[model samples]
Target: MRTTLNIEDDVLAETKVWARRQGLSAVQVVFRLLRFVLSGGMEQAETGSAVVAGFRRFQETSPKLVTNEQIDQLRDQVGL
Candidate 1:
């Protein structure tokens, strides 16, 4: 990929330093980090952990209203 990227000089320098520290090419470091983020793996793991940790916080909250059983609902009322 012989393309130009307009990146901030300081950030690019820092990325180069980190890449060197990891013994990975700058491109490899960028790609791996991007995959870890954009693949949804990172968010999914964080969300799952947060859900488990915070679920107890909602234990005291009550629903303001209630409706019929979802599975037995009359779909035609809402034109579903």
Candidate 2:
């Protein structure tokens, strides 16, 4: 995965600092960080805990149906 990336100067400097702190090369730091983010590990890191049950309950519920009659009524009410 050798490719040229146009990273910002500030971000490059930060990565270098992080690499030194972790005793890793810049490439290793970048790949490890990318893996953590892409694998959804960043969510856990930000929350400081694992996801709880019943989280995002809306995702499990069915969506409401908007009838054409309701749409027409709304259009008329709004002078559309």
Candidate 3:
């Protein structure tokens, strides 16, 4: 099927790069990525297209970075 769709430039570039490394064609990569997207395999609800790579939180090493003052302020504002 032939159709037109808009895609981000960086996505296409990364796909091409991955395809080259994996020895898969761009079409195959796109099909796989589309399936992943449609299947909701990515868990990051706020960032579409993240499902292809899965969600990864960068907070693992900085879990205690927030100050208690900020936490208390937000808690009071939210009536928590």
Best-fitting candidate, scored by TM-score: 2
Off by over 4 Å in 2: 49-80
- In model 3, which residue pairs have backbone atoms overlapping below 3 Å? 42-51
**Candidate 1: where are CA atoms >4 Å away?**
44-80
Which ranges of candidate 3 are over 4 A from the true structure?
Answer: 44-80
Give per-residue CA lDDT, model 3, range 1-80, as digits (tens): 89887879998899899999999998899998888767766545444335445554443444567899999999999999
Worst 10 residues of 3 by lDDT: 43-52
Please give the range of 10 consecutive residues that has the lowest summed lDDT in model 2: 53-62
Pick by lDDT: which candidate is best?
2
**Alpha-carbon RMSD to native, per candidate:** 9.1, 8.9, 7.0
Per-model TM-score on C-alpha atoms: 0.48, 0.57, 0.48
Residue-by-residue lDDT tens digits, candidate 1, 1-80: 58877879897798899999999988888788789877665655655533443342243255565466653476766777
Cα deviation of 37 in candidate 3 (Å)? 1.7
